[model samples]
Target: MQKVFFISDHHFGHKNIIDFESRPFKEVDEMTTEMIAKWNSVVGENDKVFHLGDFSFLNKEKTKAIVDKLNGYKILILGNHDRGRSRSWWLDVGFNEVSEYPIIYNNFFFLSHEPMYMNKHMPFVNVHGHIHGQKYEGKNYFNVCVEHWDYTPLTFEQIRDSVVVSEEQ
Candidate 1:
């Protein structure tokens, strides 16, 4: 059986991540290379990988290049960076789907770029990214939380372990 994984907010071409965030790479090209390599290491041709949003800093070409080189079929949930482009642009690039927010995966809520605000109506876990693990304090919300961005696919058990909850859950 193939495994499904979720990740978000790589911001590949964003200088802020390279300068402020102090990412290991000095440029987006280097970053993309490492990210693609890392993702391909864990994900296989049969696996499914979900990328939330803000994948790159307007460098769709480079981003597409990196994605095309990776293993697994990549699905994209469009983020703020995807603005100003046609809806079909993502599919034309390589993404299977381009959604706005709150996509569903195995009854779980999946979001990228930013953490989707949750209410009582949803009992599903929200696996999200877009931060250095600073924005959110808990391991999970709704049900589970994924808060890292190294282009790696995580196991369900890893996500479940990071979940945090309130009394309502």
Candidate 2:
């Protein structure tokens, strides 16, 4: 069986976001290249990747070209950018999206995306990346930053063991 990973919000080619966040890439090509390289470094060809949406910048062809070079099965969770990207004729080359996934682990069901309005009350931990380091001042939740295209997914075990628990009022 192949390994699985998850990532989200890699808004490539958006110079405005890059400038504001001080992204290392000077251009889209550079960002895409780096992201692919980083992903390959940690993930394998048969690995599974769950992208939580906002895949790229510009047209779908531009984004698809970059993702096609990667070695893995990518599943998108469909963020706002995907609305425009779906129209891109070549967007399908890299990813597929699904509504919800119910995976059992840690004696609970791990759900993804779709803003966990009541996640705090749920028995399982909601693994997501829509929010950066914002929200939930202190919690064991993981916020994968869209620093570069180089993003990796954290597993349930990793979250259960490594995430720092925060006090919620």
Candidate 3:
């Protein structure tokens, strides 16, 4: 069966990301290669992936090249850096869908590129990215940034299990 996954802040082709995130790679190429390997390892071609944003910082050709190599039916929730690019550009680069705002998935999971603050009384869990290595204090918010997730895509089951475990604590 096909699987669903979440990931963000890839920052592909961005050399500064290595220093910014303290990523283990020594160079952009190393980071890109490793991230691609990690992603393909966990994500099959038939799977669906929600890329929360900041997907890349490369030119159109280079960005499309990277996207084409990844495994998954990719959906992009546009992040801050994704601005200035047209929705059609993202789609042409291999995203199955491009969204500019938070979207509710499965009726309970709220997906966005940045964390949306909702009160404890809110009904949905905020699944977001953009904070990189930082922690989100909200009980119902889950960060899916590549920095936090070891450059791998997270499955819906994994996120749900984490929430369940947190609730039981």
Candidate 4:
């Protein structure tokens, strides 16, 4: 069966990101290659991937090349860095769809590139990516930055289960 996955903050081709985020790889090529391999390992061609943002730091040509080799139907929610490009540009780069703002998915999940404010009174969980290694405190917020997930895409089920576990603790 096909699944839905979430991930962000790839920063592909950004050499400084290694030092900025303290990423394990020593080179951009190695980082991109490993991340692509990890992404394809869990995502299938028919699966849907919601990439919260900061997808790449490469030129349009290089970015498109990388996106073309990835698995799944990709959807991007513009991150801070991604705002420099247009929705059409992202589509041209191989994303099936691109959004300039947060979207509500499955009725109760609010998806965005940056964490959204949520109180106990709110009914939605914020599924976002940004802040790199840091995350907001609360089960209502879920960060899918590649750094937190071994550079692999995370299935929605995985995120749901984590929230459930957190609530129980």
Clashing pairs in 4: none
Q: Please, what are the lDDT tens digits per residue for candidate 2 over residues 42-156?
A: 6677887766666667665666677777777767666665555343343365565443343333465344443354455565555555554344432434454555233555443
How much is 132 displaced in model 3, in angstroms? 0.5
Model 1 residue 166 CA deviation in Å: 11
Residue-by-residue lDDT tens digits, candidate 1, 51-78: 7676766556866776678788787777
Q: After superposition, how far is residue 130 of candidate 4 from its true place, in Å?
A: 0.8
Q: What is the lDDT of residue 68 in candidate 2?
A: 79
What are the runs in model 3 whose C-alpha is more than 4 Å off?
A: none
**Each model's backbone clash number:** 6, 1, 0, 0
* Model 1: CA > 4 A from native: 58-60, 110-112, 119-122, 139-151, 164-169
Q: Tell me how far the alpha carbon of residue 159 in candidate 1 is from the true structure, in angstroms, after superposition.
A: 0.9
Q: Supply candidate 1's per-residue lDDT for 63.
A: 61
lDDT (CA) for every model shown? 0.64, 0.58, 0.93, 0.94
65-151, model 4: which lDDT tens digit per residue?
999999999999999999998999999999999999898988878999999889978988999999889989988999999999999
State the lDDT at 59 in candidate 1. 53
Worst 10 residues of 2 by lDDT: 97-106
**What global local distance difference test value does model 2 have?**
0.58
